[model samples]
Target: MFRTWMRFFTPGAVHHRLGLVCLGVGLQHGAVPAVGPRVLDGYVAVVISSGRGWYRTPDGRRTAVTAPALVWLTPGVPHHYGPDPDTGWDEGFVTFTGPDTATYTELGYIEPERPVVPLADASGPRDVIARIARAARQGNPLLEVETGAAVHELLVALRRARADLAPDGDPVLHALARDACTGMTVADHAARHGMTPAELRAAVRRVAGCSPKDYLIGIRLGRAQELLATTELSVAAVARRVGYDDPAYFSRLFTRRVGAAPVRFRAQQSRAVPDDWNEGLQEDAEPGPPVAEPVDGP
Candidate 1:
């Protein structure tokens, strides 16, 4: 008599805008019986983390579902599935739908024709389903968006599992990318990851198709852009926040790469004007050395 836990969500305008929304998530284990041979209104992805089961499709086709496998319960499709009553099984599921789901179906990402997908590695989908369940329980203001993003990640994991794609990139380089805002030099970061600078650079280039310095700089610039657009932080503060100790140096680099001074960039973003801010500027425009500020910039 194992208890089942389930949560349902009502999506809002934001969820609709994202073109995807999670409707519900649930978990069940031990002595679970068969469920209806009826049609459902929304898409459901059921993953069996343990034990075994059987799934029947609308066309009376049957398939044995083993551990670490997934069964897609497509919208408006008649299906029946359940765990072995004697052995039972641990199950986790997320129900979701969106306008983009049709596109995904058409692209063969979500194959209603092939409902049972054997997963070589089920951990990713399991984790995502747990995340969706947790978000549903917490009922946060951004639950829809958060769960929607998780659903997208879940789909990606499923596709990777189906394609047998191993995780790409070095773990050390991935950690460095995540901690790029720490302001450490490339050599220091490499030492921390127990790799030489050259090794780190090669690994980054192999996986990210960029040098370590360029990858780190991209991460920092992305964060800086977010801070500039969303917050009222001063230029120096934003620079420091993204690991740049010198605001002047940061401004010069940003101008060279992003084609705008930080202050002018912030002003343009705040105003939301569509003027040709870079009009008359040479295609190969290169700024002088790092300066605190530039006149007529952006």
Candidate 2:
């Protein structure tokens, strides 16, 4: 028989504060049933590793579902889908909901308009599902929080696995980041890249979920923060390093966005750095081991 297992959760009110809660997770293969032609209260991401089927959109149009694809079922949106019972394809899915789902939607991570997405590879996201499945153990004390955290990882994995992200996602974003610390206006950057200001804005918005000016400014501030935390650079020097020649203006912006002035932020980070401080995982790295929980032994 093809494998099938699942667990549903009712995370407490406190778990919702994690910004995203894992409502449930499952894996099924062969003889799977069709879902919906109905609306959902939360969200579900159906990852098809090996299968062929069809899905209905909000407007009642039908779309093909092939292997290595994702079907996003959003809240209140009518969706219907299932695998071909004759072939019985492998499927994995997770349901999630939280206040941050809106923000994630805004950031283009949750594309409601494009519910069916092609994935470059299914292994990464499936690995996350495996982790979540392990955390679904009965009576596990940290099950809620552990599964909740895995939801964040799953989203990131799915984003990275997008078929369109290959050969480097976007040249424009890389170019913008490269010149982020340069003192160039949005118009100037656009002109240099042979794009009109409006085109630049649209491109950045589509890729980064923000305007070009805001995108560049974000990168600049991020660098400034890193320098402040890891180096003894003065505020003026840090400002210059991050393309802000005006130290006073930089301080104001930093305070407004970060809730602390540069000097104060630096002071707060004055705690000594650990020897292996930079050993943290890279953006696309696999998840580290889960927090240790004692296993019952007979």
lDDT of 2 by residue, 1-298 (tens): 4678999999999999999999999999985888879988998988999978889887789898888999999987888888877876789999999999999899878998888999989999999999999999889999889999999999888888888776367888898899887766787778888988888888878777788877877888898888788765678777776777677888998999889999999999755555466343112233222221111110
- In candidate 2, how many Å is residue 42 off? 1.0
Q: For candidate 1, lDDT tens digit of each residue in 103-180? A: 777545687888888877778889998888778857487788889998888887776665333456357767877878
TM-score on alpha carbons, each prediction: 0.56, 0.84
Superposed by TM-score, candidate 2 places the C-alpha of residue 111 at a distance from the truth, in angstroms, of 1.7
**CA lDDT for candidate 1:** 0.77
The list of candidate 2 runs beyond 4 A from truth reads: 1-3, 167-169, 230-232, 270-298
Number of the top candidate by lDDT?
A: 2
